[model samples]
Every structure is written in C-alpha cells, then in structure tokens.
Target: MKNKLKEIFYAGLIILVALTLGLAPVTQKEIFSLKWKNLGLQLVEAGVIDQEKFENLYTARGGLSESDKEMLYGRNNRDFKITPENSGMALHMLWAFGLANKNPILEDGPMMDPRYGGAENFASTGGWTLAKGSTMDHYSMHSFVTLTDDEQALVEKVSKGIFRPCCKNSTFFPDCNHGMAMLGLLELMASQGATEDEMNQKAQEVNSLWFPQVEKKSAGCAA
Candidate 1:
C-alpha cells in the first residue's frame, strides 16, 4: 500500500506540472483580479525565477565600467537585484506569459540577453493591451518585482552585460521586458521613498559597462 501511495503521489505531481504548463490558456484567462500574485506563482514554476536563480542572474551579468559612465542610463550605477522576496511574484507572472502562446518568438527568448526580449519586453510593448487580455495583468506583475542588496549588485552587473552602457542607465528601466518590470518596481518603491534601505540599496547596483575598467573602444557608442 505504501508503494502504491508513493506512485500515486508522483503521478499527481507530474500531472500538476503538466497542467501548469499546458492549461495556460485557461489559467491565464482569469489573471486580472489578482495580478502580481498570479505572476509570482507562475515565475516560481518556470526555471527563470526563484531566490537562488535570481541571484545567479545578477552575478552572471558582471560589473560596470568607464564608457558605461559616459552614457545617461549607465550613470545610475545602482543595484536592482532580482530577489525571491521582491521579484518572485512578478517573474512567476512572466513565466505564465510565454506559455500562453502569445508572442512565442519574443516571449521565449534568452533571459540573460538584453536583446532577447522576453515577457518583460512584451509587456513594455503590449502588456496593457495585447498581452493583458489573454493572460495575467503583465504590467501589474512586472511592477511586483522586489530586489535585495546583494541582488541589486547582480542587477548592476546583468544590466551592463545585456542592456549595455548606451542603453538605458544600468538602473531598473531598460525599455524592454526587464525595463518595464523595473519601471513597475520603481513606481511601487516610490511610495516607500528613496531613503528607504531597499531603495537606497538600489542606488548602488551598478553594471557600469562604460567605466574605465571596460575597453570602451570595443562597443563605443554602439547604440
């Protein structure tokens, strides 16, 4: 009986995961009311988010440089880490988006690559209209992101790696998926005030891809 029970449990788990990924159309049809909560849960299911993975993404992006400083966007040099406690809910919402068969081309892109527009990018373009009607409130979910100090440092790095110094300053807003998400978070954080520990922590997150450390000549004014 114990063995049978175990098998049943495993089968049930598999079914749940499948349904999570498969029934996206049905699941997403009712996302507006809850918004961020729905997104956070979905991000948890997709490999794209979670505490550890979020931190790793920041680390993977590297740090800022000289040329990065020359640009308006790269000047911020602050941290906007993607921590589980903060951006978890938002990312889960993003996960459900790509699965919804909306913009398969852009929705399902490389998370680490700035050019690889994902749910965040789609939200920047269609979150309010195109994507909103089909799935969760993409804008609200993106706004739900919250980052920790360490994660902010990671954001500084990743922002530089993908967003580039010439892009939008290494701050949270990059005019893409992450960018929109960053903007949403900023709006949410605004009420908390810039002096707040978390908001202040964001100021230090820098991926200065334009500073003296980097060979600016390589992509000088590439944008």
Candidate 2:
C-alpha cells in the first residue's frame, strides 16, 4: 500500500509540473484575430512608419499585399498572420505602438522610476533609430491610441503578468528593448479591446516569434 501511494503521488507531481510548464501540444492554428489594416494605418499616421518606409519594408519581403492586390489599398482580412519574415516587422510596429501610445502606465509606471538611471538610457528609449530624431523624441509622448480609464487599467493588469526572456522584469518595468516592445503590443491590444485571455495568447505567439531558440528549448524540456 505504501509503494502504491508513492507511485500515485509521483504521477500526480509529474502531471502538475507538465501543466504548470505549458507542456501541452502547441498548435499552428491562428490563435487570435487582429485587424492589421487599421493597425498599420494607425502606425503610419503615428509616424511609426511612413508610406515610403512601409512600402520599402513590406516590398522587400515580397510586397505588402502578397495576394489579392485589393489588400494593398484598403482594409484587408481581420486575421493577423504571423510568419518568420514578418516577425521582425511586427516587432518594429509593436515598438512604435509602445512608444507612441498614450497611457498612464508609460507616464507613471516603473519606467519612469529613477533607479534605471533615467529612461533615455535604456534600449526601449535609446535603441529606436528609425525615427526622425532621437528615440527620446517620441518615447511615450505620442497619442496614437487613446485608452479609457478601464482600458488603461486592463493594460496595466495585463502588462504586470507578461514577462520577457530578455530580462527578468515584466512589461510594467520595460527597462529593456523587448519588454518595452511587449508593453507597446499589450497597450495596442487593450486599446483595441482585446480580452485578457486573448492578450495572453497573442503575447505567447509574439514572444515565440521573437525568440525561436527559447521556444525550441521549452518544447524540448516538455519532450
């Protein structure tokens, strides 16, 4: 009876560990739908990317509208597709979103704290070079998306839970480049009315894209 009880306990422990570590089957199915057309236009309008740069960037990858030339002009499908080639572009757009979006989290969050030796010193603030002037010129100063009180709260709550592999800090802190980019993505999702669950799902997808080796190692651990 003692041996049997020990086996049962160990089995339960293994199952618990697997679940906690997200060892379940990963899927290729589209997890969430995002309106890229609107987001793209907004990014452009916010000076995240201009028409020439947008065209140049996307065209270099094989034209903005891969199929159905109509997508080139007006709104395309609501489903946001992720691919290896576009992953870097997505990061850039999200970085822009983080920089331009207006929210109290950027103003009052840990990024504003003095311990980081000033916000401009960090990657999120200093790493951005595509903009017209210094990245500080646009750091959390633009009004791309206006979030309501509740929406702002949602961003804050979601940001606290999301962590980046690049650093130990959560998006709320956003000291590094990846954390700041994630913060921007979270803010965009919240302002666009993404549910908490959806935000988490999208975050996982984005992070996986950003760090392929990390995802691979994680999967290997489960195996």
Candidate 3:
C-alpha cells in the first residue's frame, strides 16, 4: 500500500510538471491588441514623423519588416498586436502619437508645470528627433484621437497609476519617452472604449515587452 501511494504521488507530480512546461510558452506568447488602423499613416502625413528619418533609424538596426512598413505607411485595417518583435517600433510610434496628439493632458498636465521650465526641456519632447520640424512644432498639435470629456478623465486617472521601471514619475507627467509612449497608448485605448481593467492589463503587457530584462528578473524573484 505504501509503495502504491508513492507511485501515485510521483505520477501526479510528473503530470503537473509537464502541464506547467506546456503552458509556459502560451503565457509568454501574450499579445496586446489595439484598434490601430490609419493612425500610423496619419502620423506620417501630419509631419509628426518624417518617414525618411524614421526608416533610416530602423534601417541601421536591420530595417522594418513588411508588416511594420504597412502599419506606418499604409492602412492597417486589422487590429494591431504588440508582439515582442514589434514592441520597440510600437514604442517609437506611440511616442510620436502621444507627443503630437492634441490633448489636455499634454497641454495642461504636469509636463507644462512651471517648475519644469517648459515642455520642450524634457526628454519626451526634446529627445524626439524624427519630426519634420522642431519637436515642439508638433507638440499636442493634432487631433488624431479626440477623447470625450469622460474618456479624458479616464485617461488622466489611469495614467497616474501606471509607472515605468525607468522612472518614478507616472505617465501623467510623461517626462521620458517611455512615459510619453504610455500616455499615447492610454489615450488610444481610452478613445477606443477600453475599460480601466483592460487599460491596466495592456499597459503591463506592453511594459513587459519594453523592459524585458527587468520583467525577467522580477518574474524570477516572484517565482
């Protein structure tokens, strides 16, 4: 009887181990879906991002794939997925979106606080060099995704809670590129009617992709 019980326990343990191993890849393959259509093309046409400079920046780093190019220059009718491979590109594009999109958060939020000197002084604005003109020229200048008053409030509320590993400031401040990109993503998600829970979940997933090494270490500790 003792021997039989030991065999049953070991067999159960082996099955559990196999199940965990099998599910690990599926969990790691998580993707963030966004209602991205012509937003990328709009960014290019609006001079928020000079196509030549944007292409050159990626060309030196092994060029944009066909799917990436379509997202930038063509009408991507499908919902965009932020995969590990495209997360870096998504970061820059969303940075441009957040920087250029006309929103009260950028105009009246913490970025414009008198203590910061000016909005251009921060990396989120000054650090972007791909614009057709001075980065400030395109700063909060376009209405790519006009949010309702409620949606705007939702964005502000959620942005306050989402912070990147690189900085202590929340996305509401957007002093860095990561913060700005997050702000852009929040606005886009809110505009598309994403609930607060969805916003938080996608934000976490995107952050994991943006800072994979940090996430890996954090995951290791948790495990």
Candidate 4:
C-alpha cells in the first residue's frame, strides 16, 4: 500500500507541474510590432503631444527610460516591439496617435453620438492634457495614417469586437483612454495590411500587458 501511494503522489505532482507550465502567462514576449518610423516625431511636430508635457508626465513616473526616449524622439527605422516594460509608454503613444489621426471612427462613429454631449466630454478626449491646445483641437485633425476605404471598414469592424478592461464599451465607442489607445492600435494594424486574425491576436497580447492585474487573476483562476 505504501509503494502504491508513492506512485500516485509522484504522478499527481508531475501532472501539477505540467498544468502550471501550460498555464504560464506570456508576459515577456513581444506582443506587437510597429513600423514606427518617425511616427512619434510626427505626433510631436503636429503638436498633438507637447514634448515638454509628455516628457514631464513620464518624469513624474520615474522618468522615461532610454529606450522609451528613443521611441518618442528618435527616427527609428526598426520595428518597435511592444513588451511589458514599455507598454505604458506605448499606450500613451498610441493614444496620441489614435486621438490625433483623422479617422471616421472618431469623427462619425459612436464617439459623436448625440447623447454623449460631444466627443470632448469623454475621458479619452478631456484627459489628454499633453496636446498643444484643447484636446479637441487635435481630435481627428491630422492625416497621419490615412486608411483606404476598405481598410477603414476593417478598422470599424474590428474595433467593434475589441473592448478594454477599464470599460464595457467596445473600441468603436472610445470613451476612455484604453479604448482610444486600442482604436489607435487597430487603425495602425489595418493600415499596414494586417489580417483580421493578426489584429485580434495582437490586440489580445497588448491588452494583457495594459491590464496585467486582471490578466494575473485570470491566469490564476485557470491554473
């Protein structure tokens, strides 16, 4: 009986190890890639992100790391990889891009719904204080990454399915920072000819990083 019990214990231990490995969270992998050549420079030049204010925000949060500085100020020809360490900066970068980029989603979509009292009233709009003027001044005002008609349709369709942990609304109705940042990401992906599956995959990866606490709870529950 003792030998039989030992065998069962070892078997259960092995099974537990395997399960733990299987459910390990993907926290360090490259979540998404952007051909981010001078896009950050463009945003600063357009005054959508005041360089001083932008830098100050990060300074208060332990200052921007050298890599973060490069992404925002340097003309990086290399594909920008989004990892957990820099996801916060990426969020703001994409938020600025999403907010400033002229797209029908911001101009004509649910953001403009008559019941919202105006697009400027939402956190996604009013919370962005880094702009040169009122956040509304840059709202959908720049043609940074213009999408073709078909591409725009893809963005619209995909945005409807993507929701942030901060809110229940889909990216189609970007009332908060996460939703707006995601909208920016989806637009960039679509403009670069990313397929629907690729967009969805990247979105999930990025969202996990953006909301790590929620992801941790989810992983724990699964394990």
Query: Which model scores highest in TM-score?
Result: 3
The TM-score that candidate 1 achieves is 0.26
**196: Cα error in model 4, Å:** 0.2
- Please give each candidate's TM-score: 0.26, 0.69, 0.85, 0.84
Question: Pairing residues by index, what is the TM-score of model 4?
Answer: 0.84
Model 2 agreement with the true structure over 77-115: per-residue lDDT tens digits: 465555565666567666777876766777788878888
lDDT of 3 by residue, 196-217 (tens): 8889888877888887766533
Model 1 Cα RMSD, Å?
A: 20.0
Q: Write down the lDDT that model 2 would get.
A: 0.69
Candidate 4 residue spans exceeding 4 A from truth:
1-27, 215-223
Write the residue-wise lDDT of candidate 4 on 1-223 in tens digits. 9999999999999888877888634446677897888889899999999999998998899998988888888886478788888888899999999999999999899999999899999999999999998899999999999999999999888888777667767888988998899999989899899998888888878878887766533211121
A best-first ranking of the candidates according to their TM-score comes to 3, 4, 2, 1
lDDT of each: 0.36, 0.69, 0.87, 0.86
Model 1 lDDT per residue over 67-170, tens place: 22111123232333333222433432333333331221222233325674444344444432323243334322332344555444443443343333434433
Cα misplacement distance, residue 74 of candidate 4 (Å): 1.5
- lDDT-wise, the better of 3 and 4 is 3
lDDT of 2 at 94: 69
Candidate No. with top lDDT? 3
Worst 10 residues of 4 by lDDT: 214-223
